[model samples]
Target: MDFATWDDRVEKFRIPAIQYRALVESLQAENTIFNDDAKAFYQVDLVASLEMEPYQHQSEALAAWKLAGRQGVVVLPTAAGKTYLAQMAMQATPRTTLIVVPTLDLMHQWYAHLKAAFPDADVGLLGGGSRDKSSILVATYDSAAIHAETIGSMYALIIFDECHHLPTDFNRVIAEYAIAPYRLGLSATPERTDGKHADLNILIGKEVYRKRAEDLAGKALAEHEIVQIKVKLSQHERERYNKLMQIRNDFLRESKISLGSIQGWQHFVMASARSQAGRKAMLAHREAKEIALGTDGKIRILTDLLAEHYPDRILIFTADNNTVYKISNEFLIPAITHQTPVKERHEILTKFKEGEFKSLVASHVLNEGVDVPAARIAIILSGTGSVREYTQRLGRVLRKGQEANKQAILYEVVTEDTSEEGTSARRRNEPQRTQRTQSKEGEKKGDLKVVYGTGQKKTPRAAEQLGLWNDSGDTPNF
Candidate 1:
């Protein structure tokens, strides 16, 4: 018999919540009977409301999770029925579930879907002015992390959608404090730039199942093509770009700093604030990037692409809000940013999906979380060299449409003879390229890139000339 003095201050002997799972299993291994009175959650009788059959991928993903003890991450491309996968998991576990999402939009979206899936159960929201809690709860990451201490023990199952965001400094506490014996993490791209995604191994679980975009392209996802459109800066713009870059490069050379590695970037950031010359060089660097990324030639190409794909759904992505607003005003297209109101965002998405709006523009806000309309064309005006960002943007068009034979096109407008050339090459190194990893034995996989508007499937001369067609990782001549 296990016995301990009951501490009146704590009411009874207490253990860390995370150890609850191990303790119960240990007691069961010894064939000891114990009351599970500490558990506030109980098994539920939930079922998926949708009559649609589960996809092969979804079924297989859930099976893999079950094999992993109902605690692991599943990596699937966006629009691959991850929501349905979550529903299956809820039915499998049938316990009080807390579904945490990255955004308020997703929180509400989950609330609506789960409520529909279980019409009788109360679906509560924990963010955006909604604070109801029930057997099933949907919460924004902010709200969940803030209330983890109180609500962590209330749920037996926890599902983290877009779980990549859970590794942040403030968000990790939700996982650490939660006693949910069953946990699931869902993400299209879980790798974080800061390497914090590694924490997910301890917080949630290891990756149990992964299906890349390439893995499901023809069957589950729409077959798509990536086209690189290299645009050159004009003479005046080139002159200014060269001058600013020269200043920045000189400062880098004098400081023996390289912008190639994360450490080098950190060093440059630290050195930039220590001296007057360094500060000027930093300003010069910013101006040069603006000139390169916001070149007029890209705008011209975008205009032509918009005309070429007129009346078809299009998504225009930019690196900054200024560029998004500029394109939105110039082309009279709808714009979406984080600053957009909730109702406005909902209306814009509804209209875009219903064919009332032909195109939409956004900075980084549209890359994930909110459900964007399925678009046929995606034009990258400017963006960071993040593979996750690129994949999310590409996913906006990867959902198969009613036209079975329609092809999705992603146009990457790259500025030639500038830093963007290298940036473009790096963004294509996502796991979508045959799920390749950074190891010595694994051979690199080829990308599904095609030449732009050439009516040919081969690489175009412009992309070849700018070295944007290859992942050779050669240094660019500034």
Candidate 2:
């Protein structure tokens, strides 16, 4: 009673590896007699090498995952002990395990964590040029997917870090081809712009448990405030930006297309590839966007913000690599981009953590998957409108550190009178544009509080709490 496959040369029946668990379950359900000889995973004694004070929220999360039969995703805020929670899961269900992460940085981080956590277990690395086999494997998504078929039955429990990435065309195969009867997914923001997050329910399981940033503000994470500071472009920059945007707008108006909807944007991209005029319009739009995101005014404001929070570790985030390098070169701070080599990136991050570098800049690479060191401040020069991106940047500085009651801050320097304002608002709100007033007023769920609007208070935290991912296991639909 196995998945059907025939080998012509051997003239023998073979079982499909991917269907191993289903066949085993079906066999057990019907009380069918069969000799099991293809098992590849075995239980091992695993205990945490270090003792940790059990957090109530983590305890609850582990309980919920176990209640769900260990096949679900746990959505928690960044730097709020997700790796610790995963270690707990491993200890509770000790078995051959595979942890898949999205980047080489994360792969190495997990390798270190697993080795430290399970000193006696045979922990191994599967990416970054080292392919070692052990009971516990930490692999990058690329390497794991390439070897998915061969290693399908090797692990019993598959843990997907940043599982939101699992729904991609190729990476999903890592989950599909594995016969791990148990699965756990970890993410700070699981919802994707493409709406592929729903596929996670089938690949891993439903959202078993979740905790937003505000939920554990002073406990698991540091008390933090997010302030919005708006800046305007110079007169010359403004005129040039307007002229470029006009060209793009004229194309859109003439073609009867709007950039407001995803479908319309897709149509515009296709049209852009088809004609010279359309392509020019696209180039105009891109250049205009660059101006808005990297206005000289932002740099002026950033210089002040950096000075205001001197001696404190800071992380600067930008939407474009150009802005990252510009800030790095102008301020003489180290920067990380996709182009940064793996060794160089690791060295820079280590130096930042050691206080050799008080400030560092990057373009999207520090968003997630990498273990960002504790920094008290985050300055966003530019970024997409994704709430996930906003939350992750904020989280880079929210890790509780040596300073008690340390009030972390995230200053978002936005360009005024451009598409950025609407984009900023979109990041803080869901599709329906519904706003529920909070008694506290505006700090939960990646919301930005205006520091210059009505009055300026010494405390940067806005006395506002707007909306949050509800406690009922998912983000609020609104």
Candidate 3:
């Protein structure tokens, strides 16, 4: 095809440049050879060997990936050895590999793991202000996307860590530009609210293996419990919340905007940008959210819980950086946010791990891909409604420890009689339902109850007596 014709076809079909390999392979199978340029340049020898025996589930996942022609996504819970599985894949494939991660922290984590796994080989870094290339490379998504077209052809295999981030408009280009015939995508939660995860089938491959938190809870992960603590807003905070909510509700009603759908939210955002009334409504909405997320009553309950769980490593999560800073200042705890310097963040985490710091506070920075296996307690002061976010936070504390009877606890602090209640309920319900279903399946198979939050069920009355629930009921209104 001529250049103009090829460009037209590519634009019309939305065809990715990476698919050129498949086309060439099909033609070669038909006994057609266009040129010597179609030959593969990445015949790599395996220099890294497996350091340890693979877990049963990890072996099963590897077998499945090999069955699928060495290309697919594997869904494993965080701290369930996903990185090790990727290392195994690299050993089996033995090709020039590029690993893409979501954040700078994860980029460094992967680089360290790759270095340790392949000690004899040179591993390169391509993010956090460093740009070096080697047979095995670890890069942040932003860096990979920026240089994808230039260096995409150097790798024969591409592994996408936190592969859910790959489906974005920009990040997807990295997969499109690479001619790698072998690919693997890894994620604990691959489902996206924008429905972009479907593109994984084209970008990487279909999900060849899957496991949930309940699927490997007792054996691979720690036994855990999720405690929902409902704290009421003070009278003054309640009045302020009600007034701000009233203004927001009135504006929504007048504008006939329903936030039940994504389109409705987009419309509300655009409307808010274009008019004065809309701006006031937006401000009111923000204030109401702030009130619900960071109430004095919640802080009081947090104080009680901190005292109760003293000396156990705790990780506190919040919805915004403001709340993170507030909790950090109030509790005199080290805080890690996006604004935190890399050196400071590392020091904070190191101290927390060594038990020098009993607790750490963060907004959304630690929600994914950061390893904190020593954390046994997690307190959610405020968070988003996304199930992925909730699951990641829970996984942070569920990593198994040396003690066989170790029980990880996640305390979810929600403002009662506010919109956060519904958000919390919706996010919690789906995961619980899925866990229950998986737990029953495991029982039918005569396997151990591989489920978190099922070891000792806490009743509502017990929770209330323990000050985790209000006296009104399990879920108290007002």
Candidate 4:
């Protein structure tokens, strides 16, 4: 085709310049009808073989993929149909693909999704519970790290799900060793508080596209109303908390522990909580007084919240198995943990989808790639210090519904004046790219928002409220 004809086609078809270049390179190398000039080598057929229908933003993403030579991150929100984008990429390339997931649940989810979309394609699942070996293989990071040398040499494409977790040594090693010519990393929240996400950018490719949560609230994602409900501690718990604090202070001072070192603080806390020899004296001092355990009250609060919001799907997250068991038993909600049997876990998830179960109490299991979008609400009883967990847990509830503008409710129950409060504050204050840019002079300052309540207001102040750094102006219900 002549330059005028090529230009006309490009404009008419919305084919990007880079895509035209790649296509022309392929066509000219095959000795198709063309001129020999360098400029003549820059145009080709403007056709896309993408099987799935692209979302509104997918065209923009396609341009980005073309611009970046199809090697970079695509940052779409949880329910923004990123999986569809990956499907399109697979269809466009028509190449053998290897999909790596962070967890077994996601490995299964991806396998099922790909199978449903491409029924005739040979799909495989390589994880703790699934059979392996197929053209489109879904494998866990742990499993891939061990066999990537053999598998990675063959696949033409490699797609990482929940790719934010790829920074770890095993996954990175596998990605680097993989011979796949095409790489795509998918994540709802790609940045990390520890500032290690730059490693992910390098491990996958440059960030080719990004669509933020606020940008898609009403357009591509469900609208969300974040609420914080606080419960007060009883008087009997107050006296015991005071004595426990005094003992913790004395033990820490005696042990000369430092919070600046994460490992040291972690070891110190574990010792204090679990070791009889290390902190038995401290517990003994508080044992004489009536101590209140928050698990029962927290479970009751969670069940009541579910009752209040019945018929809506809920995913409950907790940090410990004890908390998960308590919540599951008290509410009679099916629970999934690391210890849950694989067969039973699948059954629980299936029942949840059929509306046989309204809620699922899990210990950090549903935080990534589980495909539990029926959940309209999330209750975070406890979480790690990392901001990624907070984002992932929130993403679990942000998936779109048949009803547009679906409401997502996230309730965070934090212990006043405890490490939980500090962790929550740290999560909210972590900087984002837009927030950083908005801080410039002459720019509009972005509004600061918090998912959890500030522990400042209460009808009757509880004992734990005395030393709490609650700047949010709301009391946490015990």
TM-score: which candidate is best?
1
Error of 1 at 259 (Å): 1.5
RMSD of every prediction: 11.0, 7.4, 12.0, 15.1
* Model 3 lDDT tens row, 156-275: 889999999999999999998887888999998899989999999999998888877766768788878777676768789999999999998898999999987789989889889989
Residues 1-478, candidate 4, lDDT per residue (tens digit)? Answer: 2321334645543322223344465676897897523221111121233365566676566456545655678877676788778887676556678888887767777777887888777778887866577778898998888886567555656788778878876677667666454678888778865567798666678777776565556666677756544343456665666667677666666777655557766767677776664566446433422232253345556767787899888888887787788777767889998898878988998998888988888877776666674678898877776666777777777777676768788887654444445566665544322211211223111222234322323232122123322224321110
lDDT of candidate 3 at residue 141, scale 0 to 100: 94
State candidate 2's TM-score.
0.86
Compute each candidate's TM-score over C-alphas: 0.86, 0.86, 0.84, 0.71
Tens-digit lDDT track of model 2 for 159-254: 999999999999999988887878999999999988999999988988887777777778888888777776778899899999999999999999
lDDT of each: 0.82, 0.82, 0.79, 0.65
lDDT by residue for model 1 over 1-478, one digit each (tens)? 2423457897977666765676787888899998886678877677667646877777778777776778889988887889989998887788889999998878877888888889877679999998887999999999999999999789988999999999999999898888788899999999988899999988888888787766667667787777776677889999999999999999999999999878998998899899999999999999999999999888888888888999899999999999989999998999999899978988999999999999999999988788887888999989999888998998888888686866888988877778887787788862222221232223212212235231333322221123212214322110
Please provide the root mean square deviation of candidate 2 (C-alpha atoms, Å).
7.4
Worst ten in a row by lDDT for model 4: 38-47
Flag regions of model 2 displaced more than 4 Å.
1-22, 430-478
Query: Better model by lDDT, 3 or 4?
Result: 3
Candidate 4: residue 182 Cα off by (Å): 2.0
Question: Candidate 3 overall Cα lDDT vs. reference?
Answer: 0.79
TM-score of 3: 0.84
lDDT of the structure predicted as candidate 4: 0.65
Backbone clashes (count) for model 1 = 0
